[model samples]
Target: MLIGQYFQEKILSSVKCTDKGSAYAKFEWLFGKGLVTSNGQLWKDDRKLLGPSFKLQKLTGFLPYFNKHSKTLVEILTKFQHQATNVYPQLVRATMDFISESAFVQDSTYQINDEDNFLAATHMALTSFRLRLAKPWLAITPKIWDLFGLGKQDKICSQFVNQAMSEAIEKRKIALAQEQKSSSETGENHANQKAFIDVLLDSKSEKEIIGHIMTIFGAAFETTASAMNYTLFLLALNPSAQEKVHFELDSIFGGDKNRDVTLNDLSGMKYLEMCIKEALRVCPPVPVMVRKAQEDIPLDNGQIVPKGCRVVILIREILRDQEHYPDPEVFNPDRFLPDECAARHPFAYIPFAAGQRNCLGMKYALMQMKTCLAHILRRFHVSTSQKRDDISLINGMVMEPKPKLEIVLTPK
Candidate 1:
């Protein structure tokens, strides 16, 4: 069986799925009825409530915040030129700060340049839990090697992340409570005072807010980081594209000054935008998405995916299909120059996935990515440390470049 299909079949086993149970009855509570893990009325309601955030108007409000954090990224990467530091890690930190600052009104934080590396530990713990959650049968046929105890490993990492996230939530709650109290007395509260979290808190219960934050991070951080990483990798490999990106930036905003590029300026950087889109097409951060059939659904192939059947959508495959993209393997930005991308199915290029379960923070994620790339290309030139023969991809919940992508940065 193919890697994707094998995983699906394992999720569709008979014991847990015996018709009465939902296709995704397990882990349903953890992920909740937001995107990526919900079904029926709850799923649709969550989708509708979150829809307003992705609209163009809402995204425009995030620019000032994006500009603030993208500058932090530039300062951090400014160090990469003299030292062969892993620039990817810096990008990860940059995106984290961007989200933490922008996602809530109360938490306007800057990078202490923590480089906490909490995420790495958290990833290990979560992956272990996910492995166990995905493959419960392992407990049935236990081996001593397995007893090397991922349990303890999980608890340690989980403790670190849980502490950090819990602290953030607690701080946010206290700040909001204070803000609300002040608003009541002064009666001078501004409408813009509410952030993304406030809107969710208003519309949904507190428990739902917790789930939304968890889902947002799970979908947001790694994807934006990967996008930034691939972008640098591509720029490093193809100096011409890198130069073109800078030229586009210069043409719109000029080469000498450091001014906040507006939506109009952002729109003018068409070529650079195309380059980002192509990079996403070739190496989408979330290359595939898995869903469980809510109920029996029929496919065009005359086969029925029963109620409990697990469905894996191979977004990468669909993107690279030669029939859809005539020269599928080529990394040409011109392919996304409106005429071409507009011709393809929206679902065909599923970078963020699609439908009711599409990524909720899609607008915010794109805003962060575009701002970072636009700012960086204008400031520094990116290139790989050594020539690479092939650009192979790493598979995980979010696909990342394998074998540490090292790039050189010189003043542009």
Candidate 2:
């Protein structure tokens, strides 16, 4: 296992080091040959082609979708106010809604309303994936496993999700073709406001597009939802920290809690951003990431990582290192203040990993998170009796609080 910022910078920044680890391969069944599971030239080509869709300026176009879904989330949560409610599932569905509109240009209210079974299928597939990872004996060849009916349910769920995404991709391709014909006739251009699927359709085959869409959507929604839930959990445990977030939100929206969050409003949310950053540091969505060493790489400790070694980056340990963060267990958003952040090593706190293969949707995730939190905090006072020690986290695909995250939401 690789610990410390020096290794993080050296290995993650290396040109030859690829994310073709065993853990990543486990995702191939669900994510296919998407960016997350891809390596080498294919990964590079996909990253470059998809890069423009997530640019900071282009992200501004997604704020409306973020705000709309966040409002829906507020309405949904209001029903459970004054009672301890497990909000993680709701947050995940809301984020699914956000990604559906922003990335795929489709309405996912059916999933949110439980009319569609996509979310349940996804959860089943992920649970089975984790189980298979834990018990290697259960990870037999697909044909043998199916013949024995060992992973029948998981296989069905995986097929359901893949089919759903495939259909969505095909539908979008046809719509894009018609839109292009209309635009050509009218001398109009909308290259600047293209959705993520639209961009992929321009340069990818249908099968390839399905893989990219599933990969991007899965990565974006699940991690963002986990991060948001963890932040809310921490804020609920620490009222003062929660109040600081409320104060910052009040300063920005000020008596108009129902107003949509503007780009300027998002930029001005310094303290809220700090709280989110601190939450990420405490309980990152992905606590561990694995990258395979393509070639022998030397470390500052005078040891060389052998070629083809599976190097594990312990992100949770690195973020909580005493050398970098004092009183690391404390929930202090001020730890992320400007001066303190400046003094820390660049790789000391990589919630989204770092270097070339870092998360492409980092900016988009943060914006969606901040906007959602702003909407919720502005209208609701979230509190929970669950203590930090009582919560057990499952460090699987995404770090999830086991037994669900139950919290009370009272009107502000």
Candidate 3:
């Protein structure tokens, strides 16, 4: 599409993007208003202040949260041991609970599927949102289906979610204001749960915090759950790979359930890490990253992608590059062993993305995914349903293998 001779080159990485009205504009759209959405100094400032939260060491405190949520998730899945069912939903609920606890610590209602708490409005708004939502939400993505006229229904959905967030933000502002005043009068050091909401409330504006909480909630719950779901799927596909992970767990922890996995233990999970890397190579959570050419950047091929262009970094294509990855289609975990993997360009396999816009949830998400996998694998022998191949392959803002991810879980 960008004048490359072949499809692979065009999608892989041949040209830098610049069009505003192109698919490559999705990332720019999502982060457009906030630091994540921008490229200049605003992005720099936000990244500088918030980036340290993701550093490996600063995140150790969240391990207990991950472990606890993982145990709860495993308990839920164990209840369905005999039935052939999709595991992704279970994981979604679990990860959502974890992220919700870590973000909107004061709001119990944000956790979906709670019997007494339901966001019928949210579900209603988002369901027909793409097709029926208004122009602003639709326009949020610079590149999308504009062939059809913009619908009022779509706009309403957009308004609804925003309205919901606005209400929550207002309430949080009042609550925080009261807490601050109360603390000042009593001279009592207030307690906070350190969730994203708490993090933002400390230094940022209420409205900005609202925007960030929405973005973080979306990223934290969905991407991590997707990663965990795919990990389970890949392990189900490769039993030997799962066994190797089990072997590592056994060697490292000696089947002792009391010994919780720590950061050091994660480093010891070399093969399991490779398996995760290889799975990501095959099916990244965000398969393609979209970027806009805010300014023209020249490439090695002497092509200058002019400003205002939209670019699609087809990470799938790059990860499967025959030139970079020999036997590109195979799910070979050993391909990621330090000696084998260090030979390639780090940019070639970008599941989490590259440069400053990289995922802030990377460390937290990885911890959640890895710990859940370790716990589940340690406790049960897992296998896919007979109909796994027949599962619907649905593509959304994220790609998912639908329905029949049904796995047979037996007590180990």
Candidate 4:
């Protein structure tokens, strides 16, 4: 087993680039050739330019959007009380709206009932990519996918997303210019809203702005939905854990389901955080991520990963290693306790990955999960007819629970 000598040394931090240039090539069609796809100086420059926007203080500004959208999710879940239903779409839409509000400073209007073609195109494009991933020949040759009509549909979807993003970028640029003029004339800097768009708008070109914004938007939702989905699934299967989460919420908010989740509330949610962490450990949204060795890299055990070799790290497996987590298969949040975590290797649990090229929106994603779950558990009791063994997860960029997730929620 490549366990003891390999991972314990934390060699992943040595990785400088993802295999996004190849593995996520199809994604570049929709997301533009941005940071996620670029490498070396381009990736470094983009990372440098966009880093501050995801800082803790900056992410705090996005809390209101998370809180606002979580309420909508709670309302939707309440409507489906006592019924076994798939809640993933609602979670995706909530995050979609949250991203819209936080990044575009407006609504994308991607409601459950709306015929948003852009959203449909996004779904189709991802499905096409997933299909091609399973059948590598289709992806290996662009003509093969186009011959089967998959590539055309993917392009159309990419165009739709790009067009929408382009329009949004233009509008923001004009509005920002006007705001600057107004401020200059008034001799007062009254910029009321801070958003991801503000950071993207600072980029040198419109294409650069679109690329960065789409990169942020592209990375935001599906991963978050997966995290939320598995988190809810784990909590539902383990009622003892669910009850503890409820108790924590009740104590914090005084049983007020409608209460706003402040940053302070999230900090106080120590146990809920553990539950989320443990859930991610077992069913990491991005189960496997590929990194290419830039140079000859030596492992702690006198082994070397030659340059240009592809390294795939199994995040889910490592998190469940018996050596690190006793009773590895169990859904025990206590395993993530501070003392317990400190005792383990630093790289034992990396849901968002690690090092210089880790997920940029990690802090943002965690806040969204905590805020949304806080609202959800406080307002409703979650249970599912589906057992743990019933979960059939498919490997995409994220681990998607197959068929559908049928959870029953009862309003508290």
Candidate 5:
């Protein structure tokens, strides 16, 4: 790739990301001027405005929602026990419902497998965007894809997403207005119990509110679902690893399949956390991250990434590099033990990226992953017919296992 001597120094923390780049613009079709796609002052302001919602304390408030949905997911998947079933769709539905409740304070019926909902339209839009990004020439002038009818369905998907989100935003606005009026009349403020949508409504326009809601929905649901899918897939193929995970879950839950996963419980899941990290290392949700160079970056080998150049940080490649991770292809959770991780390059494992511009919802996503796995692994033993090397992968905003991941779950 580069001068071998400078390999370790190239990815240092000093290189700042300029912008999110063009691939993310496809998201603007639905998330108009929202957090993930914006840059400069707009992005900074939006990040500050929304940062507190994802803070650890606030995320604890979402545990009940995550646990409730995780139970629903387990119940639904119970119907498929002992049979090879693709759990990806069910995972997506569960996460979508969870996000809907957390972000909008509304219960989405998608968990009931209703495929005609707005959340379903969001899934369609993401597929279209991924397709658009695949064709470099066509994506350069995105409207050309529309001309070839490739974007017709995407257009319809966008319409569905926008219409649905807009209506939700309007309803939230009316509800907030009424609540505020009543609060003023009664001289009692309910500021302590405001929902995320309520906070966004105070500062953002209707379109911007819808945009950020979609941004959170699009990013959170799919990526978390993919991460969980890969984690389960890896555990299925490795019986020993699955047994270890079960051991940890059993030790923690103590036969309480329905117990709520507390912050302390999640913190104590050292080995399960390792398995999750290794899964992310082997198959990061977003494999390649793009950043525009704001300033020229000098390499130890004398090459310079000139200012304004588009820099592609291959996250999957980095995680797989043998120099950083010995026996990189292996699914060994032992590699993430504290001392082992401390010995490696800090940048070796960045499933969520690094620096100031990293994922804002990092804590929230991790909590969901840990909580959902706690619920499922405690109640069932997972098994599969696929091998790690034989699994097919597709490139999108998130990496997906192709041919669908079919696995069987047996009650513990």
Candidate 6:
């Protein structure tokens, strides 16, 4: 197990020393051979091909979808006002809707309808994927497991997700063709604002497109939702911090809660961004990351990692280390204040990991999260009876609150 900044920089920054660990192969069954599961040339090519879609400028185009779905989330939570509600599922659906509209150009009215088989199937599929990773026998005997009906649900869920995403890709292709034809006839140029799916459709095959879509969907929704939930839970337990966030939001919006969050507003949300960063520090969405050493890599501490050895970076522990963060258990947003952050070691706080293979959607996730929180906090006062010590996290692909993250939303 590796902890602290030096190892992070050495291992993650070295191109030849680490690709992805072998464990990520298990993700291929569910996420396909997308950017998350691919390594070497394939990973590089996919990253380059899809890179333009997530640029800061491109992300501004996604704000409308974020605001639209965040409004739907607030509306849905109105029914549970003053009642302690499990907001995780609602958050999951809201983020699912965000990714669907922004990335796939599909209208996923998950929040309004409250019934999404695709979302449920995705949950099941993730659970099954985790199970396979835990049990080596399950990974080896896929045919036998299916023959004995042991993997029926897993198979069904996987098939359903693939088919659904495949169909969405096809639908977008037809729509794009029609749009292009119309633009050609009228001499109108609509090329500046292409969705993520539109960019993929231009270069990738159907199978490859499905892979990338699933990769982004799988990476984006649940993890972003988890991060939002954790931040809210932390805020609920820490009213002062929550009030600070409210104050920032009020100052930014100037008592007008209904207006859309402009790019300038997002940039100006310094305090709220601090709370989000602190929440990420306290409870990162993904608790651990594994990287396999490709060659004999030497560490600063006079230790050598032999070739083909798997190294686990203890993100949760590293974030809480006293070397970097003092009184790390305390919920203090000031830890991320500009001067303090400048004083700290760069790799000491890598919730999104570090290096070339760092999360591609980091910027996109932050934008969506900030927009959602700005909307939620502006309209409601969040509180919870649960204390930080009482919370137990189940560490999986994402670190989730074990029982559920329950909070009471009292409208301001």
TM-score of 3: 0.78
- Candidate models: Cα lDDT each: 0.66, 0.85, 0.63, 0.78, 0.81, 0.85
What TM-score fits each model? 0.81, 0.95, 0.78, 0.93, 0.91, 0.95
lDDT for each residue of candidate 1 in 1-412, tens digit (9 for 90 to 100)? 1223223333333223222123333333334554555555666677777767666776777788788778877877787775445677677667767766666643443355345545555466447645655566653433632576755665576566556655666777788888879989999764543566666866776556656765666667767888878877877788787788888888888675367868898778788878877888878887765565556655445666677555666778777878667777667788887888788756566687654445667667766788888888778877666544555676666685667777787787
Candidate 4 structure quality by residue, lDDT tens digits, 64-100: 8888888878887777889987888888888888887
Task: Decide which is better by TM-score, 4 or 5.
Answer: 4
What tens-digit string does per-residue lDDT give for candidate 5 at 211-310? 8988888778989999999899889989999898888888888878888889889998999989999999998989877776667778666878777776
Give me candidate 5's TM-score against the actual structure: 0.91
**lDDT minimum window of 10 residues, candidate 6:** 1-10
| lDDT of predicted model 2 | 0.85
Candidate 3 C-alpha lDDT tens digits along 382-403: 7775443565645455666755
Worst 10 residues of 1 by lDDT: 14-23
Once fitted onto the true fold, the runs of candidate 1 whose alpha carbons sit more than 4 angstroms away are 1-34, 82-85, 106-110, 113-148, 156-163, 177-193, 203-207, 300-303, 385-390
Task: Give model 3 RMSD, 1 decimal.
Answer: 5.3
Summarize candidate 2's per-residue lDDT along 94-203 as a digit string, tens digits: 88889888887777683357757677787776677677767656666777556657568867887788788788887788888898999999999877778998887768
Using lDDT as the yardstick, the better of models 2 and 5 is: 2
Query: Tens digit of lDDT per residue, candidate 6, span 53-169?
Result: 888888888899999999998888889999999899899889989999998666779877745667777878777767775665867767866765757887788778878878888
- What is the lDDT, from 0 to 100, of the residue 54 in candidate 6? 80
